[model samples]
Structures are given as C-alpha cells and as structure tokens.
Target: MAYISVLKLILSVYCFFTLFILCSTAPELCNFPAIFNFGDSNSDTGGFSAALFSLPPPYGQTFFHMPAGRYSDGRLIIDFIAESLNLPHLQAYLDSLESNFTHGANFATSASTIRLPNRVLPCGSGFSPFYLNVQYGQFHQFKSRADFIRTRGDIFGSLLPREEDYLRALYTFDIGQNDLGEGFFRNKTIKQVYASIPDIINQFTVDVTNIYWVGARSFWIHNTGPVGCLPYILTTFKTAGKDSAGCAKAYNEVAKYFNLKLKEAIGQLRKELPSSAFTYVDVYSVKYSLFTHPKKYGFELPLVACCGYGGKYNYNNEVTCGYTLKMKNGSEIVVGACEKPWKRVNWDGIHYTEAANKFVFNKISTGAFSDPPRPLKQSCFNPS
Candidate 1:
C-alpha cells in the first residue's frame, strides 16, 4: 500500500510539472491582419522609387531579380516581417502601377528624416522631401481615401485593405537615421546634434499620437542603427576615433544618445496611451553586432560597400552604385555590384545586404532585443 501511494504521488508531481511547462511555453500569437509601415529606406518597399525615379538594375538582383524599389541587393527587413506574418508584401502607397494593398501599405521612402529637410533629393541635398510629418499626412489621407474607394465596389475595393484591418494592423516605424545623417552632413557639432534629438523624438511622438487617434493600437518601433559603422560615415569622417571593430566611436555614441531618448519617449507614450501596445526594438544592437562580430555571422568586409565605386570602403559620393560615370578619355563606365553580396554586410554604403537584413530580422523577431521581450508575432500583447 505504501509503495502504491508513493508511485501515485510521483505521477501527480510529474503531471503537474508537464502541465506547467506546456502552459508556459505555449505560443501566444497575435493575429495582425495587416501591417502599416512608415519610415526611411530601411523599410521602404518601393515608396522612394515610385515617388522619385526607379532605381537601376542590380539593386534587387538577389531576391526580386530586378530593381524592386529597395536599396539593398534584395529584400529589406520589412519584407521578412510581412512574410513571417503570412501577409502579402506591402505595396508602396505612392506606387500606382501594379500595386495591391489588401494586406496593407508602405509609406517609407529613401533618404527620409524624422525632421523636415531644408532641401530634397535630385536637388543635390540627398534627402527626401517626404519627412515623418509628410508620411503621417499621407497615412491620414490613405485611411480616408481607402475607405472611400472601398465603397465603390470594384477591383480597386478588393485591392484596398478591409476597414476593420486598420484597428488590428501592426504599425511599424524605421525612421530617424536620416535626421542624424542630415545633421552630420550639415557639419553640426556633436553637442548641437545631441540637442536636436529631443525635438526629433517629439516630432515622432506627435505623429504616433496622431496615428493612435486614427485607430492604430499596436506599434512596433525600431531604433536607429549604428550610423557610425556604415561605410558612408566611416569614409566621410576620416578623423573620427575608430573602435576595435573599425566603427566610428563618436558617431556611434550620438546614435546611442538618440536611441536612449527615443526609448524614454516610448515609455511615456505607453503611459499616455494606456490602451495601446508598444514594442521598442533595439535594432541598433543587432546591427552593431554585425560590425563587431562579422565573422560570427558569416560576413566579410563589414564596412565596405558591395556595390559601390572605387574607394577604400568601395564607396564614392560622386560615383554612386549603378550610376554611369563618363571618363575624361570619352569612355563611359557603369559602377556595378560585386561578385558576391551574400558574404557582405553593407550593400551600397547606405544600406544592408539582404543577408544582413535577414540576420537582423531573425534576431529581433525572437523578442530577445525587444523592450518588453515579446516576439514579432506576439507584439500586440500588452504587458502594461
């Protein structure tokens, strides 16, 4: 009788332990019907290309087999995100041809800044006129216009997202890098740049608030990456102190400062908007890891552009990638991509290759780098 009682007790304990494990580890995923993305080239599907001019070939050769309006050699992190959620890739809101927005729309454009720029692209400033505020305005217009178009009951209605999806959509942001770059390009002092971060974050907060008012509840915001580690900053600021990994130390510190402020602002937003779910993704850490430990990630030439013109970092502002340059001897040469882009981190001095972006997406999607430690699929779960 005693042996039988002991056996029963052990069985009960084992069952309890198994149940606890199953309950704790079971997946708690959010069913986000759509994704409304906003930002710069980091997540731009084709906004810049549609709004301005289409990018030349070799831009999307790795994945899309042609210029797909992305700056990288293939898909961006946003593309991986959409794929993970089982949703169709978002079409640029600015794109009119061959676009379908049933799942959602992308409002990101290359060279976009959180703050308005004094000058824009093609005019030599290299910044996009569609800044953060302008993106918000576009989104506001899209919301109303899409609803209006859906009422028409035609093929266009099928292409637009369902009205209910707006409330359940995952709102993503990947801007602010260009704001810092803009300041640096203007030769602003580090202190001046530091001082400008607050206003920049405030602008971001206001747009987010406006978006919230428009029924967006789940927000997944990405902090700016390591600007100092990029080939553009490294080659431009030759005198900046280099870390052991070859990244510029001072510029990286400035980026860190911006991220710190942005995180704090997010915390405040959580308080102010109690009903919303906010996920702060530390992409800077993930991206910086590539520079610090490139070999661990199966990458080489971490700071060199894979598809840029002649230079120490294989980048040139004068002769950018895919641009045809005329030599003095009347010969024309087109700057082309390297033989292997998968083994490289930087794509064209300003963006990450598809491999690097995939690595980043894999890391951050695991929730290890999120503020609340929630996976990408579970981002809508509010801990507060």
Candidate 2:
C-alpha cells in the first residue's frame, strides 16, 4: 500500500511540473520593456488635480491613502499596465513636478482632446467654440510630448540619458471617451457624431505618427468605452426609456463604429511605420463584459453606482458618497451607500471602483496584453 501511494504522489508531481513549464513557455504577446502613457482622466494618475485643486472627493481614495488625482478609487489602466510590465506605476507628467522620469511619463490631461483645440477652456468644463483649434495649436507649439521628453532628459540626464534605447518601450493611449461624452454626444446627433469620426481618427493618427517619429515604437491604443451606460448621462438626460437601454444601444453603436475605424487606422500605421509595434486594447469590449457578466467577475452590482444618491441613476458628484444634500425646497436628499463598496463596479457616475479597475487590469493583462500583436509580449504580471 505504501509503495502504491508513493508512486501516485510522484506521478502527480510530474504532471504539475509539466503543466507549469508549458504555461510559462507560452508565446509572448508584447516585448515592451518600459511604458509611457498619454490620455485623459481614464489614465491620469494625478495630472489634473496637480494643476488644479478643485477635484471631487473619492477620486483617489482606493489604492492611495489620499486623492492622487486619479478619477477612480485606485489605479487606472496605466497603473495596471505598468505593474504588469514589472515596472513602477508611470508617474503623471504633472505629478512628477519634483520626481525623476527614468521609467515613463503620463501627459494626459483631465479634459484633453485629441481633436484640434480652437479655444482654451477650464479642465472638466464642456468644450467651447474653437476649443479644438486652440488646443491643437497649443499641442503643436509646445511640441507637447517632445518638449516634455526634452525637459525630462535635461533634468534626469544623469539618471537616465535621452539616447538610451526606449524603442522597445510601450506607449498606451486612453482618450476619446471624453471627446465623445463631453462634445458630440452632449450636443449632436449620433449620425452627426459618426460623420465626424473619420476626421477625429485622422487627427489621432497624425499625433500617433508624430509619437513614432519621436522614438515610440510599441503602442497600445484603447478605443472608447460604453458612453451610453454612464450614470451621469443616464440620470441627467432623458433617453428613450426608463432603463436607459435605448440610449446605451445608440451610444455603443457609435463607439463600435469608431473602434472599427480605429482598427483600420492602426493597420495603416503598421504598414506606414513598419518598424513600430502597435496593438489596440478594446476598452469598450472589456467594459461591456464587466457590465454584462458582473456575476462571473465577482461583481455584485452592475447598473447602480456604489457612490451617489436620490434615485436609481442620480449620482452625487459634488457630495461625498455618504453625505446628504439639501434641496432648494429645504428637504434633505439622503444618499445611501452600497453594502460592499468594493464589489460594486462603478464608484461614481462614470468611473469604476478600485476593485473594478483591478479586475479590468487583470482582464487586459490576460486578454489583450497577452495576445498576439500586443505591446508587452513577454510575461503577464499581476498588478500590485
């Protein structure tokens, strides 16, 4: 009996070792050694709040003890990507007001637009006339990212030189959601917005091509998220019906159209810049999966936000999650909190909670970041 048991134990051990080796030796998805980010609040580690101090509450209350300017409770997608790459979280360009930039930098502003800026507006304030033209001109004048790199090179020359090979570094972009949400969707029809997508995509392509010129070879681009499902839009705006099903469908269709065009654009970029490595991370698909498969992903709530109050979709952006608001009629609007805050998908109207962000990071690491033509192709690391 003892001899038979020993044989079985040895067999199990051998099988475990074999499986581990096979999994470890799987094909790589991306070959990115370092990561740099450029986008809006979705990936802004602390840029907006660093420049302006009027940011809302519960912004960075998840991972960081205090508000780190991130729109989420914890880390954003960039933070997860950096952690997956075995690198420290990429510092915000503004947050690095006193830090070194040896690893990477994030130049995403809260309300930065990829489209040309015609006028300058306060961050988070809706776009005004000439917003695109003015911002685009400013983007060009500052030589934007290049200027940032040069400044960093000048400052951190002793630590990390400019000539050092960053060709293998991954550059991730997560913008355009704000553009659609704050611009076209707020004012124009879906058809009108869809018509302008080509121009918007073309402008982005130009900007990305410029980044390639500046030594960014590997790229991970994220398409727009599901704008229709956002709490702010559903609660504030009167869509087709009660559950916001119609509004979500319409918005998602536009997003899908944009993503399709974006894919083609990336394909063109690959042909145009053969030496550069590019991959598109489908933020829309991932976010949709989270909403549709909340139970599968261990999420308890999918529709309502963990934060906010009043009604089903009435999210309180100005007040903290547990605070009470006084209406004009002298009646108090009491806001209720979710039982398990971490289990809820959304923290506020539009942003995800820390747990959701972590789950999203995991999905990206396993799905997109570990698939063919990804930016980081070696091995996937769990976000810290």
Candidate 3:
C-alpha cells in the first residue's frame, strides 16, 4: 500500500512539472493576430530603404542575401517577434502601397530619435523620416488607406486602423537609443546628457498614452541596451581601459541610468492604464548577459564588430560597415560582411547580427525578463 501511494504522488508531481514546461516553451499556445513595431535601426524592417536607395551590400546578407535596408547583417529583434507570431515579415510603413500588411507594419528607421535632436541631419538623410513622432504620422497615413488586402477578406473602408484589427494587434517600441547616440555626437558629458533622460522618458510616456488612446491595448516596450558595449562607443569613449567585457565604464552607466528611469515610468504607465497589458522587456540585461557569456549565446566575439574599418575594434568615423568608400589613392575600399557573422555579436559596431537577435528574442519569450513577469506568448491573452 505504501509503495503504491508513493508512485501516485510521484506521478502527480511529474504531471505538474510537464505542464509547467509546456506552458513555458509553447509560444504558439497564444495567438497574436498582428504585430506593429516602432523604433530606430534596432527594429527598422525597411523604413530607411524605402525613403532612400536600397542599402548597399553586406547589410542583409545573412538572411535576405541582399541589402534589405536593415542596419544589421540580417534580421532585427522585431523580425524575430514577427516570426514568433507566425506572421510574415512586417512590411515597412513606407514600403510600396501594394506591399502586404496582413501582419502589420514596421515604422522604425535608422538614426531615428525618440525626440528631435539638436540637428535633424541625424534624423535620416533627405526625405527619410526617422523621428518617432514622424513615424507615428506615417502610421496614421497607412491606417487611413483602405488599399491593404488582408489575408482574410476584411475591408478597411471604415476608420483608420479599423477598431477590431487595432484591438487585436500587438504594439512594440524600441526607440530612445538614437536620442542618447545623438548626445555623444554633440560631445556632451554623461552628467550633462543624463539630465535629458527625464524629458526623453516623458515624451515616451506621452507617446504611449497616445498609442493607448488609439486602441492599442497590448504593448511590448524594450529598454535601451548597453550603449557603452558597442564597438563604436568604445572607440570614442576610450577614457578608461575596457571593462572586463571590453565596454566603456561611463557610457554603460549612463545607459543604466536611462533604463532605471524607463522601468519606473513603465510601472507608472501600468497603473494609469489598467486595461492595457504593458510588458517591459529588460533588453539591456539580456544583451549584457550575452556579452558576459558569449559562448552560451553562440558568439565568439562580443566586443569586435563584424564589419568595420581601422583600429582595434574595427570602427571608424569615415567608413562604417556595409559601405564602399573611395580613397585618396584612387581605389575603392569596400567593408563587407564578416565571414562568420553568426559567430559575432556586434554588427558594424552598432547593430546586432541575426543570431544575437534570435537569442535575445528567445530569452524574452520565456517570460523571464518581462516587467509584469508573463511570457511574450501571453501578451495577447485576454482575461475576463
């Protein structure tokens, strides 16, 4: 009798553990009808490309086998999110009007800032839109158009974003890095630049509110990663020797300061919008974790950029990655993609390679890094 009772208890524990494991890894358990994203180079599907000529070689070589306007060698974090949702790659809002929008649209652009910078040049060259506010306006235009043919036979002749579709879509934001990046370009010390973080966050909260009012009840917000860890930053801020991970000390601290405030603001937003589900992702810590344990994330080099020119970290002001440069000696020098892009973490000194992005997305999907502490698959789960 005692032996039989022990077996029953063991079976019950086994069943519970199996159920927990299934819930943790089953991203398909929850369905997200669509996903809409906004940010800078970190998530831009092709916003910069649509506004300008197509990106040069080595930019999208990893996945697209050609330049698709992404800053990285391949997919961005937003791409991973779309894939997880079982949707086609999100099209850029600026893409051709005929482009498919069944999965939603990407409004991110390279060099975009959450707020306008002291100079607009960094906002993307020519008619290219890169400010978060401008991206929102582009979204407004796309929403107004009823030209999009959904996979299902639903017509959008109604109001922009059609109430039902907007309610079902997942909204994501990955901006604010360019705001801090601009601070560095203007030669502001950490102390001086840190002062602006509050205003930056204030604008972000306001934007979230506006988006919330627009019927977007589900939001996934990514905090800025460790900027000091980027090869470009190390090249510029070489004041102190590299930390144990080959990152700059002061620059990383500034990033941490911004992340702390951002997290607090998200909590406040949760309080203000009780009906909305806001998941704050700790991207900074996740990226840093990969930097510390590169092998675990399938990276052999975390500090050295895969495509760059000159110096220890291979980053320079004149010639960045994926661009061909004309030299004074009458020769064209092309800095292309690395032989093993998947083995490296940083791509072109700023963006991440596809492999690194996949790892980060997988980590976030596990629900371990979220603010409210639910898996990403559950973001769209509606509880009565």
TM-score of each: 0.95, 0.78, 0.87
Error of 2 at 152 (Å): 12
- By lDDT: ranked, best first: 1, 3, 2
* lDDT string, candidate 2, 1-384, tens digits: 999999999999999999999989866555455566778777877766676543555556667856677877677778877887777877755664665556766677666667854334554545422222333343344234544566664554533313433566777788777666655545777788888789888988888887777667777778877777777666655553433333367777777888888888988998898776667777777787777778888886676777777567657557545467888999986554465768888877777787887877777665463224343444322122
User: What CA root-mean-square deviation does each model show from the true structure?
Assistant: 1.9, 6.2, 4.1
lDDT of 3 by residue, 266-344 (tens): 9999899888888999999999987888997668878888988888888886788867778899999898767899899
The candidate that achieves the highest TM-score relative to the unseen native structure? 1
Q: Which pairs clash (backbone N, Cα, C closer than 3 Å) in model 1?
A: none
Report the candidate with higher lDDT, 1 versus 3. 1
Tell me the whole-model lDDT of each prediction, alpha carbons only: 0.93, 0.67, 0.81
Model 2 Cα displacement at 172 (Å)?
A: 0.5
Error of 2 at 139 (Å): 9.8
